[model samples]
Target chain A: MTRIEEAIKQSKFQDVYQKALVNLIYTANCLRDEQVRILKPFDLLPQHFNVMRILRGRHPKPVCPGEIKEVMLDKANDLTRLLDKLERKGLIQRNLCPTNRRKMDITLTQAGIELLEKMNHMMEQTHETLKGRLSEREAASLSHLLDKLRG
Target chain B: MTRIEEAIKQSKFQDVYQKALVNLIYTANCLRDEQVRILKPFDLLPQHFNVMRILRGRHPKPVCPGEIKEVMLDKANDLTRLLDKLERKGLIQRNLCPTNRRKMDITLTQAGIELLEKMNHMMEQTHETLKGRLSEREAASLSHLLDKLRG
Candidate 1:
């Protein structure tokens, strides 16, 4: 039995398909918890880091909440609320789009970029450590399987 | 590029390892959202369904908060708060343990059992539909790879 099977005290699932479904959810939480631990020192939630990362991608260019929503993995996150918190934290800047007053523009502040740089380094380390558990080949295969699962 | 590649607007990852990491988290969210949709009609959160499932496992026997906590996938869910909600919904019953006055025992009410039976049918359909996307062999391989990733 895997950690998930053991964790739930279930020796077996109905079948491999059902087992895979449960495993996918459990493994994701394990990975997320690791990243959450790294983000703790920065006083950032995982979603905060994610928004920061997206903002960094926009960098000098401004983005709207809808634009940020397009790329966010967790669809449940409220982009407006997240931007509000980031704005309050001084991590991001918000303004009206110069071209369109009706639209709001959001961009990473200097602090936000700096924070992401630090987080990217930390995440890189975490990713590397996690990758150590799987070989390059295994990692590639895992990615392929995950894609197909969603297909 | 897969859906995740497009979803995050990253054509390529730093490497397959990084891609796998992102894919794992995204795929988990996808599965979770699907389950969340099914639970929506019942006006219950997935964690609530999870608690019911655990109690159903114990059936006639009552369980304690500690026992329920041990097997919850989302460890962050406060078992006591969850039991309070479930008890209010009339899906679970809590009583003092005859042998231990300091502890309480919880069990699934008949309504809870009925709810789960309906959910199990819905879940079975969802699982079957999801499994159809992959062959049995692919599913097994996916499960094994996921297990290895956590190992």
Candidate 2:
């Protein structure tokens, strides 16, 4: 039996597809839990961390809240509220766009960039720990399968 | 490029291992978003639906909140609050355990069971939509990869 079977205490599935659905949800929660533990000490939720990464990825290039929402892992988040929290934390700055007065342009503060750099180092260790069990080929294969599953 | 690349708007990764980490988290969130959309009309959050299903899985056999926590997909829930919500909705009942006065035994109400039955039919359709892209072999392979990843 797979670890999922043991976790849910159920060995029977209607089919492999059904089992895959359960396995995906269960494993994803496990991954999110690990991230939550790692982020707790840094006072960051996953959504906060995700937004920081998106900003850092486009550092020096301002992005609007709409763009961040498009790329956010959890689409259900209240972007305005999240941005307000980050702005209060001094991790991000939101200002009227120079190009379009109606739009708000968001950017990472220097403090935010530094904090993300520190967090990035820790996240590297986390990625290693999470993916260490799979071989390089296996990791690639896993990613390929996930992409196909989403198609 | 994979659908993930398009979603995140990034084409580069440090390595396959790193790519896999992003892929897993990203794919999991996509799956969750789908669930959220489907569950919305039922006025059920995923965690609520999850708890109801757990109750149904072991219908007639009472389970405590602690036992439910052990098997929940999202382990970080404030279970007591969650139970209170279910109880308020009249979908569940928590009775003082006959054998152990200090403990509570939780079970699904007839209303809860009936609701879950309806949800289950809907869920089966959701599962098909989510996993429909993959063949049987691919589904099995995907589940195996996810289990291996958690290891």
Candidate 3:
């Protein structure tokens, strides 16, 4: 209780549901912040890592900016500048999609994949460490509850 | 599975904890989007609501910008502009601190409290609706797992 209470510096929430919402958001931010810190070594922001991850997941395949935007975790933010930066860094390639000439297809370069793979194990280890406090059953329950929360 | 899967357009995750992290973040964003929608009517963003709620909680006690930033959920974001906006809107007041002449004290105006009270029932209904899917036990379990995850 003190961990979270102290993290946000406020013990009392408006109510249980509100408390849960804040906890969920706060914890997610903590996770995001950790990722951001980890990514800082690579001179990348969380949103930048997010795009790289999306492109990496689509490896050997190509996606357009719109497609990346569609699935982005931080949709409120615009990714044009980040894309431009990644493109300049030679971590990503942007070209006219053959299928849709008007659409710009964003693809991860070899360097990008290498970079992501370089960070993959560390990220997995971090996630495992961050999640180590909960048992498998608790992790499953947390996922289930979160899925149900949106419905 | 289709809900979260389809929203992100990716089906399988590498592991359960990873899946849970994604789910937690996705659901928190979902909750945030809902709050944004509700807050739209009031022309207030979630961060703004957060500040108002914070100031309202400290009623009769003036707080400085540093104090508010210390407790803000999205502290990474600069609050000076937000404070400026709220001040311009007459929802919040900022003045020189009597105790610390160099520091600025921020507080909610009467209209701010009124505005918050006006939305209180609606916000509670939103939370109630969001929490409706889970039982109290499940909600408690979700909160507990999150706390443990951060431990």
Candidate 4:
């Protein structure tokens, strides 16, 4: 039995398909927990960190809220609320779009940029730590399988 | 380049490890979205369904809120709120532990069991659909790689 099978306390699966489903969800949760652990010390939620990453990726050029929503890994139904919290933290700012008065353009503040720089390396390190057992070939194989699974 | 690379529009990853990290998170979110699509019509969130599954697993034997938290795939910080929602939905009932007045014992309602029974086969079918591309050996290989990744 795999570690996930042991953790869920269900040794018998109807098939490998069911076992793989359970394992995927379980490992994903673990990966998310590892992210939460890293973000917790920084007083950030994964969603919060995710928003920052989006902004950082589009640094210098402000992005519209809809654009961020389109690319967010986990869709936040109430992204406005998350943006409000980030705004309150002074990590991001919204400006009236020059071309359209009704639209707002969102950009990262200096603090947001600095914060992401500080956290980015640590986040990468955590990923490396969690995936230490897998070689490059293994990692690629896993990615390929995931792509195939989605197809 | 994988579908993830195109989706994120970032064709170059720092390495295979980094690519795998992004792929894992992205694919996990996709899996969750698939689950949400299935549960939406039933007026259930994944968390609610998860709680029900836990209760079903321990049917006839009531479990404590703390015990539920420990075994939950996605740890809910405000379990009381979730319990309150479930109670309102009439899917679960909380009884004061006979042995300890301060403690509460949680169990699924008859309605909950029936609802799960109705959805269980569909849920399993959705799992099969999502993983249809992979053979049993491939599924096993993916699960094994995920286990190693989490090590």
For candidate 4, the per-residue lDDT at B115 reads: 89
TM-score of candidate 1 chain A against the true chain A: 0.91
Superior by DockQ: candidate 1 or candidate 3:
1
The true-structure Cα RMSD of candidate 4 reads 2.6
User: Candidate 2: which docking quality band?
Assistant: medium
Candidate 1 runs further than 4 Å off: none
Angstrom error at residue A77, model 3: 6.4
- Candidate number with greatest TM-score: 1
TM-score: model 3 vs. ground truth: 0.92
DockQ of 4: 0.59
Clashing pairs in 4: none
Candidate 1 lDDT by residue in tens digits, A39-79: 89988888888778777776798888878887788863567
Model 2 ranges off by over 4 Å? none
Chain B, TM-score, each prediction? Answer: 0.92, 0.92, 0.92, 0.92
What level of docking quality does candidate 3 show? medium
lDDT of 3 by residue, A1-151 (tens): 3356787888786666777778898888878888887888888887888899999888878898888998987683667888998988899999889888989888999999898887776787787686668777888888888878877
Candidate 3 off by > 4 Å: B1-3
Per-residue lDDT of A32-81 in model 4, one digit per residue for the tens? 88888888878888889988988988798998888888777787889999
Taking the tens digit of each residue's C-alpha lDDT, what string does model 3 give over B1-151? 3356777888898878888888888887877888888889998899999899889888968888888988888783678898998999899989999888989999999998999997776787877787678887777777878888888
- What ordering of candidates by lDDT runs from best to worst? 2, 4, 3, 1
